[model samples]
Target: MSLPRQSISPLRQRMLEDMTLRKLSDKTQSAYVRAVRGFAGYLRRPPDTASAEDLRRYQLHLVETGVSPMSVNAAITGLKFFFEVTVERADALAKMSPVRVPHRLPVVLSREEVARLIECAGNDKYRAALSVAYGAGLRTSEVVGLKIGDIDSQRMVLRVDQGKGHRDRFAMLSPVLLQTLRVWWRTAHAQGKLLDGGWLFPGMNRVNPLTPRQLNRAIHAAAQAAGIDKRVSMHTLRHSFATHLLEQKVDIRVIQVLLGHKKLETTALYAQVATEILRQVISPLEGLPPG
Candidate 1:
């Protein structure tokens, strides 16, 4: 017997087309679809039929259910797109507003902790991957998306194609990191796990690139093995990278460029967590004369 076929709803199809026309990334398209689907699940009807009051109530429900402010804001943006762009019913979003996300400092690991974490990774592949995340200050997605050709040993840079915001940029390729990658490449090549100009970090099958989820799991395992108590993720390495650079007296603008951040203020946030920089500061009280 043949399995039954699942069909896409016309509404969803239309939304997908709209997203594609706007050149939204696949990740973003998926998030928008999920947001609309969640709203439909709550409404018990088609999202297109949602009214202004219904939208308000749905947001209230999300808040009452303890959804994070960032997630709630994401949901709001998705719903706004659905109504304003897909269904042409912008009026329905009149009462809906995005929640204010609280600003929190990013968690960073000490240099020693980072060393221990990398050493504890399960295998060479993960160890090298984690090193790239810290050494080059790349996001997890950028690390996994790397290909053999993206590395420019001659130029001493790594080409990041289509990073966040769908923009292409180059990241630093430290001599140390280049060596780590070369070692990993030689090992994987000897095992016939690498293809010509293929993914730098391939999955078990060697066909697909290593996914963010897999990398995340590896970092968690490595952190546990290293006896690190602070909450750690792939981004933690990135935060540490920027913070360490700031502590070493690198210009904030330079760090901003290296991190591919658009705003200087966004990169300035690292100043708040750079303990070494803070230690170097002379307190105002210290400059004051004794009474």
Candidate 2:
């Protein structure tokens, strides 16, 4: 007699185990799960039973249905990982392809614009949070994940734990930012939010850290108040930080370490947006004597 089968498929269980073994981030794991679920829902059956033709057809359907290329690519990546790594059927999914996304320069706010944005934060907590984003070039998640103890006042360094790729790095803390944090800390401490060590910027529920959505909304509202036209977000602050540093003549290699970029090329992109650097360079036209 055959051994009893479980309600959950062995294939899916193994896929989850594979992801966990690889130590993927929680966000990445969630995205993979959602992508696989979408595939299964599209097929109206178990994803394990998908044939090569079925995969191609589903991909075509996604494009025909006007799904964004980035999203389509994410779904494809999930399926590829599930089949190639988890199910060990790499040959069957060999035809899978990723969408080629166009490269675009990141948005960089002017120093004045960044100042206005921070000034419009309304409250000291948000002001300090915005300052950290621009001052340290941190991601939204990283900014929200900050703990009170991460600030090293004496050494003037902020310890970032489990950043992207699960790597730890120290970001520079400016004198101005230190003062801002001190004020924010004083307020939080008085409110009993930081009686013990906790989130530097707590959410409505002080037990947990502030949510990304709320932080994003605060940034948006501040931008609106500042009367800036270009679309800006927490990421824009990071981009501006890199570009501003490049403008200041800071080496690209150093920026790479601060941003935790795996590749130097990734950090070099900021050179294109370093407006001040472009301005200061002697134009070849200026070098030429009157023609």
Candidate 3:
């Protein structure tokens, strides 16, 4: 059973107001609140009264408790915002430091694996959704957030509004993906599961869009059904898309723009996982002649 939610304290109320004034996204606001709440629970008192030493100890506590580096860093960021912005106690977090998160290459699926995965989806809706994720390199949220009118066949682009970083951009819409979407649309319309100009992927109720969690579950089931061994998620499709494009000799800058990445370095990471490009490289041993 879920525990009863504690009533919001005045300090937390102020923090919420500060976050709202900054126009932080709802997800970010919730994360910040959760981080502060966790900190307060650790202290058994209000977070506003924390000292620099307390902050340091709390960080150490997080590390000792086996929090992942990424989550620990996120908590540190949230606490920094609370102290620096809301509490006006910037010095309180002086001794607290964020942990460095190790960089690891993302998991990518092969083209054939991707095809089999999509084909194994429980239904046509999931199959089309999976296709859009790979075909346009869209995130799962973007896939479910797509609106019927977002498909711009005339311009051959998909209008992605408020994607990651709260930025709007266009994604490539291939002929194959368009046809797949049309088929899904027709099927959904015939089943009365579609609302005009509504979500491309709807939940059981047409009023709500398909959730990221639901899409994630669908992908897991599909992956198991396809008998693919590599870790697969909706994001695996996106990684495969970018890697395949790189293997096809698509410009890194072009892929960056298509992926809506703010930095070229972010898109460049895909090159490390592009097996085809790796295969095409001439080894120094080959130039030295076989022993």
Candidate 4:
């Protein structure tokens, strides 16, 4: 009798298990899985049968189909993991180079634009949430993960524990943010959402942090009401904070530390996109009047 065949590849299942074992972020795991699945679906066969030629064709298809470079790179990364970890065939992937993506500057709001976004918030909770995103240069996740104890008012520092890469860091606290937080705290306390040791922004569960999806929705609604042209998110506030700081001549290294970037290259990109820097440069054609 023939042995039973499984539907999903065991190797792919193992990869998922490995990601969990390593404590990888859920977002990363989901992305990796989706990318890998895309490759598998294209081949219509198991990943073990996929070849360099197959990958090459996929790259061409992505470009021809007008797929963004970012998405293409993600597929390449997922394939690399399958070959390197599961199949133990790193040599097969050595010659492959992912398409080079042009550096796209992040979309950041002006100070006035940020204020307009905050003013559009219908509720105090969302306004306070966004204020923290701007005031501390915090990611949405960090803002939601905050606890009452994280606010060090005396020292004027906010402690961020085990953020990206499971590392801890401190961010400067703005008096304006602190005052808003105090008011929000009182409100949460009245709602019985603030526990002795729990998330500052609680959701359905008292101890768990507020969901990122909820924050994203609130930001989108606020942006729409504010009549801002640019796309905005909780992350946009952070980008605005960094870009504004770079405009003020703050060093890239300092920005890196504050933004919790592990690489200088990551932080350097903001310098290329700072509005103030762009504004200061006199266009080469400015001296020549239009004919």
Q: What CA root-mean-square deviation does each model show from the true structure? A: 2.5, 3.9, 2.4, 4.6
Residue 180's lDDT in candidate 4? 88
Per-prediction TM-score, please?
0.97, 0.93, 0.96, 0.86
Give the Cα-based TM-score of candidate 2 against the true structure: 0.93
Superposed by TM-score, candidate 2 places the C-alpha of residue 82 at a distance from the truth, in angstroms, of 1.0
Candidate with more favorable, higher TM-score: 2 or 3: 3
The CA lDDT of each predicted structure is 0.95, 0.89, 0.93, 0.84
Candidate 1 regions off by >4 Å?
1-5
Error of 3 at 206 (Å): 1.1
Query: How would you order the candidates by TM-score, starting with the best?
Result: 1, 3, 2, 4
Candidate 2 pairs with clashing backbones = none
lDDT of 1 by residue, 225-277 (tens): 99999999999999999999999999999999999999999999999999998
Q: In candidate 2, which residue ranges exceed 4 Å CA deviation?
A: 1-11, 288-291
Per residue, candidate 4 scores C-alpha lDDT tens digits across 78-197 of: 778778876777876755688888966789998999999998986777888899899889998899888889999999889998888889999978899899889888988888878896
Q: Each candidate: how many clashes?
A: 0, 0, 0, 0
Worst 10 residues of 4 by lDDT: 1-10
Q: Which stretches of model 4 miss by more than 4 angstroms?
A: 1-9, 277-291
Following a full C-alpha superposition, what root-mean-square deviation does model 1 have from the true structure?
2.5
Evaluated with TM-score, which candidate comes out highest?
A: 1
Worst 10 residues of 1 by lDDT: 1-10
